[model samples]
Target chain A: MKEKEQMKNKTGYIMLLIVLGLYGILYFVHAGKTLQALEATFGVFKTVAPILLVVFFLMAFLNTFIDEKSVAKHLGDDSGFKGWFIALFGGVLSHGPGYIWYPMLQELRKKGALDGLIVAFLYARSIKLPWLPLMISYFGLTFTVVLTFYVLVGAFVQGIFAGKIMNEAKKDR
Target chain B: MPRNVQRLKETSLQTFKTLQSIAPMLFAVMGLVGIFETFVTPEMIHKIFNAHAIHDMLLATTAGAVSVGQPFLSYIIGGELLDEGISMYAVTAFILSFVTLGIIQIPLEFSIFGARFTIVRNLLSFLFAIVIAYMTTLSTSFLSGYFS
Candidate 1:
């Protein structure tokens, strides 16, 4: 197990180095365009990255505070409506690029978040905040109402189905 | 209760350890993204999305698939789309996919969840992204009592 982890770490590091090296080359090759892009990207990171980092840290810290047993006690399979609602809301409320959220979601699953709930959250991410206003401005009240209702409903249905399928599949395993 | 304190301490330590383990890679990736950001341009993005309806949606999805950006970037691009007379559907598709999908991380996802599962999930997400955007537009139009 120790050797396996060491191997994974080495592979991860190599991948990181390769990616970094490529970016370095790109940055230098088209310094002018790259600088503009970098400024825009940095402009983006300045606002979003700090919030994401804080969330990541809080999640990491919180995950440790709640063991599988406790998570199971609160959010386990049979916890029913309340548990499901929490999972769904938690998933919807969480933010970040989907890539960044992947590891955290994996951690949540390990900590006993139901498969359906996880799926629901992933689905809910498709909904955006700024778009809500734009959506309201463009689409208006009735359509927005129905659409929001449909998304929330779809998220729940998808989550539950995903959970069921995974469990069933796991049983065969 | 005493047991709970011990568990809490153990969990805290584990959390710290995991963050410590991943911190280097995380910072490295963020730094790379910062570096890459310096290179993008509106014309570059415009070239990627163009103006054809079907092509624009495909381009939006494809762009959303490859790039990572904050919600603000989506709004900025969205405003540009409106100004440029790009279809609302296309812009919406791009925004939806931008946050929910990752084209560049397919390999990583494949490694973590097996290729078959990862591909199917993303394919499903991408398909649903269009639907969600369409619905958002349709609803927005209905609520405003005007075609948008």
Candidate 2:
């Protein structure tokens, strides 16, 4: 057993080395351009990272404070109109790249939140930031409004479909 | 009143137990990401995605797998690529996949949702991104011709 554990550790290290080696080769060839990209990336990370870290900790704390059953009681499928509003608002209020929220979302799903609410959140990210004037200037008002409406509507539709599909999938499981 | 207080205590205990269960996995991943970022170089990224239109979309989707960042950052990069004459299709695919699918987060997803569900969801999301991006580009072109 001890030998097996050492072999696994050795294999993991070897995999890491291979990945890093490829990156090194690519890095040398494009060092100058890549540095410029890294500089720009670091600049943006400076602003977004701290804010995201704060939100992560706060949400984690809230997970501790609020009982999942209570949240489900208020926000679950049977909550009707109020529940839908909660879903929409929750989606709109959710910040960051949606991918990063996946883990937390998985947690929420386990807590009994409906698929509709999850879809609402995903679609809400399409709604541009409050500085909508930039979007208006680029895409025009009609395009902006139509797309936002479509996204909001599409989200709920997708949620409903996903709910059915996921349920079926679960039944098979 | 005493019964109510006892019930509340039980609920609190359950919440704490749940939080404790997930905390280590969460922090461990975060710590690993912090270390990994220190060594990544930008050229390594560009070479992986710098190609022609369809190929670039594939590259972008693949790049998105191992890459981690915010959506706003994707928009910024997409805007820059747009200025550099990259195809709208490529940018759209990159931005979409950048937000919806994650390569680096797979470990965490597996831990949370189980490996099978995580793999299925990510695969579905990736393929859907390609379709959505292609449609978005086509629609934009169609609309532009009509509106112009």
Candidate 3:
């Protein structure tokens, strides 16, 4: 397992090198655009920094305080309706770049969280509480409410699909 | 050391390790995202939709999947498209996918979650974006008529 993880890290380094190589080539061909891209990259890092900090802190808290058995009880295979509800609402309440949550989700998965609940959480992020007012202003109350409702339902449906397929795949592996 | 302090130290070390493990992929993802965002503009997305309902929805969903942004930004873009006479189906799919899908972050997600899980989750999300968009449009219209 450690060897496999090391190999994955190596692949990530290779990918980073390839991106840097492309930027190096682009610098000569389109210096301005390459510079703009670099700036955007910095902006992304800046935006994600605080989110990453919070996520890491949460991970640490979970690691220190929360046991695997507890995680399994709440979000594992048999967690049922309550687990799904937590994931769906948790996704809605989560704020920031969705990618930032990947590591936290990974931690949960390691602790026995269900794939379906993870999918539910990710899909349910579509209904942003902070943006509902803005969405309503542009699309009106009916449209906003209906769209949000569908997104929640769609999330649940997709979660079920993910759970079934992922569990089967796990069994096969 | 006290028990609580020992736990705190362990937590900090664990956090650091996790950060170290994910750093390379995270940086690579950010680099790719920056390049994609710098090159792809909202106007470029706008030009892709031709106002054909089904065709536009597919294109919009594809566009949204490839591109990433905040939900608020998607709403603004969706509203602009709607005003420009794009079908509600197209705009809705675009908005839904824009938030739910992240093609740029695939590498990071793949590295963290493994290939099968990442692929399945993303595929499901992609399909659901279109389905929900269709449902949202139909339901919204019905609700609007009922309320009016």
Give i-RMS (Å) per prediction.
4.0, 6.9, 1.3
Q: Candidate 3 has what TM-score?
A: 0.96
Write down the TM-score of every candidate.
0.77, 0.64, 0.96
- DockQ for the candidates, in order: 0.35, 0.13, 0.77
Ranking by DockQ: 3, 1, 2
All candidates: CA RMSD (Å): 3.9, 6.8, 1.5
Stretches off by above 4 angstroms in model 2 are: A1-85, A96-108, A119-154, B1-13, B35-38, B146-148
- Name the 10 consecutive residues with the lowest summed lDDT in model 1 chain A: A3-12
- Write the number of the candidate with greater DockQ, choosing between 1 and 3: 3
lDDT of 2 by residue, B1-148 (tens): 7865676566556544444444444444443343344444444655565548998887777665555554455566666666667677777677666666666556556655556556556665676566666766676677767888
For model 3, what is the alpha-carbon lDDT of residue A132?
88
User: Compared with the true structure, what per-residue lDDT tens digits does model 1 show for residues B1-148?
Assistant: 7876786677667655555555445544555555545544445776776688778887887777666665556657766876788887787777667766776556455443444456556776677667776777666666667644
lDDT of 1 at A159: 69
Which consecutive 10 residues in model 3 chain A have the weakest lDDT in total? A3-12
TM-score of chain A in every predicted structure: 0.76, 0.77, 0.94
The models' CA-based lDDT, in order, is 0.65, 0.58, 0.89
Instruction: After superposing candidate 3 on the true structure, give the runs of residues whose Cα lies further than 4 Å from its correct spot.
Output: none
lDDT of 1 by residue, A36-100 (tens): 65565557557656666665667656664657887776667876887767766765676655555
DockQ of 1: 0.35
How far out, in Å, is residue A152 in model 1? 2.8
